[model samples]
Target: MEKCRFHEVKVSAPSKVILFGEHAVVYGMTAVAASLDLRTRMRIKPHKSRILVNFPDVGLKESWSPEQLKTLFQHKPNTEILDVNYVYLDLIHNFLKTESSDLRMASVICFLYLYSLIMDEVGIVPMEILVESEIPLGAGLGSSAALSVCLSAGLIGVLHQVQGYEKSIFEYTSSSIQKEVCGFAFLSEKILHGTPSGIDNSISTYGGMCRFEKGNLEPVRLERNLRILLINTNTFRNTKDLVERVGEKRVKYPDIVKPILESIHAISEQFLTSIQEYNQDLNEKKFYKILEDLMDTNQSLLTGLGVSHPTLDDVCRTLKKLGIVGKLTGAGGGGFALAVLPPSISGKTVLVAKDLLETKGYTCYQADIGVNGYVIEVVK
Candidate 1:
């Protein structure tokens, strides 16, 4: 029998958008979201008694032997394992053993946690991982979640193939795998954002636009082609700090914020139902109206929650003035803003919007609805 020389697993992680109820979702309010084409990719390979992790785009590289990993895990005092960077060492140490200061370590732990649990059943082997992604980090795009999911799937695939086990892909489909992957992804998100709604991973795994209510995901259908402009402020916002700050406002302005949140929930339900019924009459005019209402509602609620930063407000105002419907995506404070433009607008409207945003020092990209999520490509 030919010995298995090399095995590889490739996976893509997707970006996301919040159509309605951004901050309110944290308080049990409903939110609508979709996955974007922007994605991260990861590949894994086995080495002789060694593991190498590389991020070529970022110029990061790390390698260690299995014995070194075992020694580190064994906690043999004064043992000089490989002289890896303290940051990388801390990651492996905490992930394989304890929770520590490194976010990447926490992510690795989540991946390994699921890997150890699920791999034996599927029969997988340990392998080196090379992760590369086009999704911009800290852009409210769920790049971290993509990384975690790709890792989990790659590890699981290795275990299955190496152990001579078999599981129908259909059997692992749906939220079971999603829930498992999210569990790991959220750990990393916690280290990054303090608190994440897990919406990013949820949509990225499931694909399609969805309305999440009380932890249940209901996919929504689009009636027409919707053009969205994603504006990147190039600012990184800590999700945890933003969540805490919003929490403070909830306590401070419960009366004012509560009703707004309730209203958003109602709108989201209506939006979901409308899409489910396949209302083709839902043209650009109706879509614009709905988006406008959602934008105004979201801005007010975010302002009440005190999470709206100056850049966010400016983008919203700019979109409104230009007669385009838009709102800030994700936890606000800072990150990307999304605008819904009318289809009838001049072809130059896109260029005009881009110029206007660029003039204001914001990066812009035209995004389309209905992009694929979490695709698997097999390579021999």
Candidate 2:
């Protein structure tokens, strides 16, 4: 492998949905999560001697000579990512006359960090980086993880090409590719969620159903693909804040909160068994019932923890009234809720459900879960 100007590379990572377990996952509870079709897409191209980053999703557009990014890199090399995530998110975070966007900063940090880390081995020409995402900004749908994964995949993909890393070896074992991407995404997750649980990065990088428990992750094989109606409460919530709040509560009310946390873990455990049953037997009715019951339980536990919002409640109630099971999917102060569609559901039924939910001033996306994860393509 040798350094050479590669024409272009495109990479994308899917947003993730938590099928079961949320705040509880932090406390050794197993959580089930899947990747969504919605994704953050990034494209990179060689430029002469500077870097250009465009994020239309957040109204951020900036170009800097390599020296500028290098200066920022040296400004505080050991400054923790949490510091960058919390306050200074971009090279321009303190620059005069620049608008503030934390997402913009985080994305910029990942780009610079990964570029610098890999570019040490081989110098890269200035590059054009364009980032756009279909995933909502603050919705707990793994937006930050996805962004980080995309950048990681993009940089690594380009790195491999520039180094002329053997494609034949990477060709036979793509998991190796995902493993590298996941590692970088996890580091990026630290910038986004502070002490991230690692599930979001894993799910987004692998792009499928995973049972993540107590720091160990294993894949779950489902016989049939699942469709979920992702409804945004149009609510904004921060994962770090919600996670910290739950931690505070646990310490404050150990007896009460501990049991509840265990109960939530039980729900995930039960759901895992039910999924095995469904996959083993292809019993849609049985699995749907289990999912409905488990989601209801999960939602109640989350509400008990004080994370549920009025909008989240309304969404859940609406779905329950229609005999559709639903629950809050993420940090849940208010962000997104999900209704897993039964395998027998018809297109008309789904459309009606989406319309009814949309009429309530909510945004709805119909996406299949457990899809493929991060991907890279070179434009020859």
> Which candidate gets the maximum lDDT versus the true structure?
2
The total of clashing pairs for model 1 equals 7
Clashing residue pairs in candidate 1 are 122-160, 123-159, 123-160, 123-163, 124-158, 124-159, 193-240
lDDT of 2 by residue, 8-63 (tens): 88878899898887888887778888889998999989887778889888887778
**TM-score leader:** 2
Ten contiguous residues with the weakest lDDT in model 2: 79-88
The local distance difference test score of each candidate is 0.66, 0.79
lDDT of residue 340 for candidate 2: 92
TM-score of 1: 0.79
Which residue runs of candidate 2 sit more than 4 Å off their true CA positions? 1-3, 67-103, 168-173, 238-257
Candidate 1 structure quality by residue, lDDT tens digits, 288-354: 6765776677677667667778898888888777777667788888898887766777778778878
For all the candidates, what are their Cα RMSDs to the real structure?
5.9, 3.8
lDDT of 1 at 45: 74
> How high is each candidate's TM-score?
0.79, 0.86
